[model samples]
Target: MTTLTTPTAARLAGITRTLSEWQTADWKGFLHPGDLGWNSMAGAEKSAADLRCWTADGTVVAIGMFDGEDLFRMAMDPAALDDDELARQIEADLTSGRVLPAGTVTVEARGALALRKRLRARGWNEGEPWTPLRLDLRTPVPAHPRDAALRVEEIGLDQADDWISVHWSAFKGTPPSSDDRRRLVHRWTTMATGPFAHLAHHLIGYDNTDQPVAVTTVWTAGDGRPGLIEPMGVHGAHHGNGYGTAITLAGARVLQQHSASAAVVVAENSTAGALATYLAAGFTASEPVTDLIGSVTQRHP
Candidate 1:
């Protein structure tokens, strides 16, 4: 359980780094407990040891853990092994504990196609890359988005339940049940205390009658960089309309008011149109390293 190691740990970490796929885990970037999409039953069983990673030679490569898209992050040590031989050894080490084990695996890569090609050759399926876009905060705010009828307003703290309901309804698909929605609202509301925390702040886009329809939450990373708008979406009934573009600008406006230099959005490739909408709102776009996720299930353990 103790990640504290001397020389041996260093070598294994070196190999893992050479064979690395993504680097977010290397930096301890775990998802918040209240974020949507994290499975509850899976969460209860995770512990520090689950984060404890090792090499085929029984050496520690890094320290970290993952829960689907929740609480997942890791870091590697490059000082431990020969750079040339790192990937092979580390790939073996990772598969040893079922990290990339069988079943239907979800792989997300935000940048680069070469690495994805390598992964594809190695039997891992690639997923569509979600583009990252940026909107200058100082730019003039354009007229509201024109599409389906919507009501945009600053959220009231007393409306946590409403936030949870709207987000749950908008984002419900595979994982992150209604229970996850409640916890997510709770985390965004009170439990989290950081610049990136937007629990107490958000922009709600509603239907003509003031019912919640689209939601966008704003938060800044600890590094004081541009604001981040994540998991923004509209209900199924509201898709293909200007609600997405309108609320995106609305959220960007809020972050700008808070003194953000720029606001960035990260979303699946399917969101390109939404990005275009943002451009119309005076924002620029950036191409991200796209990773295609694919998986081959082994018949037996």
Candidate 2:
């Protein structure tokens, strides 16, 4: 019997392990374990609270994370991709509000054909598309000309503040409040010390004036598995300076050092500039994939 339950710390670790094993040289648009690690920015406890797993015979077969109140991103074991029992169980829970609220919900299940087929039969439609890009780590990552002038550093606890500063400046575009800063610090601490810490690398780049201008976090599933660049950004003030490409190449180099088969990231199709940055860093783009959108009220029997 397949049962759905919120994960405890042990179960979450298991989910992370399974996700790592699921990564492949071929991009499948599945959830990366780094996605879970990135969510640690919300704090450890909250990250756990937002996760759910489906288990059968004492092993996790599917994992899901709620990305906000309406979007649920999920990945299943490759063996379970076409499992009808698991698909029906997931569909029922999703529609019955056991997993998400009883209303509109967006599910990112690009690799789960059975679940996606069920959702489509029940009236789900495609959401916005996202482009997946990858850099082969078998070859040395070509250096960007900007690499010559920028100093990239692998940061730790002492430099957590630097990471937080540039990350917020790049994404939020304003100074974070004291409370927000405190929370961001806690988030970084949790991630850096978490169970999967060995797989993570935090890097920050500085220009000639020693100003931190960009940041990236790279996570490896393990040797030979694809590595992920979950959230890479250049400070808004430094956008036109090629810092984005510089930081991205820095990340790919870290992945190669860790023996990753490839480095992968996803960008919303709307973010043309982000895609261009990866291209500039020697990454190749794959066909885009879209999330499945459905309303609970329209659930079919």
Candidate 3:
């Protein structure tokens, strides 16, 4: 029997695993295991509650996770994408508030060009474009051209506050509270004991005075697979000091050490500075992906 249901926390592992298996280089920058890992490890309790799954005969064929109320990041097995019956069923559920409420919303689907075209015909418009870049790690990554003056360290429980502080400083926002950092530390620590522990790493880069000035989180899909540097940033005070490239290279090294064939990252097409940093770190750009935005409305059979 095929059914729709909200996944409980216990079922998160299965969902993330299925998503990882479906990921291919062709679907690079789409939803993947690392996205879920980052969510779970960073203690995205609220977003976790929003996860939805479509299962057929005890197997998950489709999954969706909300980045926020109006933006749903999702993917489906390629077979389901080609199955007319399942495609219609998914459309019905999404429009009837079974997946999300009625309103304007966006869905980023991997290899769903047909669905995107259909939605566009129904008054939906294309959302912003995102560029996915990758660095080949099949061979050893060359050392940075600049001297290695900065020091990078793997983040641990004791460095939770420092890590959070660096992130907030980079984004210029209200800092995460001590309680929030504690939750993140707990989640990361708990994940370390789990089956997927080998695929994740959190690193912080410190300046000469021993102040944390940059942070990054890297995730791999196991050896010889493509890895990701989902969130990498340098503190605002340290922006011009080459910390961005320094920390990004550090993240790539972590992934390479784990035997990843390549390191990948996605950023808004408009984020010129970020794109430049990755390019400087030895990454080459790949084809861009677009997000599809539409109002929740009935689609005729």
Clashes of each: 24, 0, 0
TM-score of 2: 0.94
Ranking by TM-score: 2, 3, 1
Q: Which candidate has the highest TM-score of all?
A: 2
User: Per-residue error at 36 for model 2, in Å?
Assistant: 0.9
Q: Write the per-residue lDDT of candidate 3 for residues 1-301, one digit (tens) a residue.
A: 6798887667766776787677665545777677776665444344358688988998898888887688888888866666656666776677666776667888887466556556666676777888888888877775774327779998765776787778777776556677866775576565544545556788999888888889988888766777888788888877778788888888888888888878888888988889888988888888888888778754334
* Residue 25 displacement in candidate 2 (angstroms): 1.6
- Give, for candidate 3, the lowest lDDT window spanning 10 residues: 39-48
Against the true structure, candidate 1 reaches a TM-score of: 0.57
- TM-score per model over all chains: 0.57, 0.94, 0.86
Order candidates by lDDT, high to low: 2, 3, 1
- The lDDT per prediction is 0.50, 0.88, 0.76
- The alpha-carbon lDDT assigned to residue 29 of candidate 2 equals 67
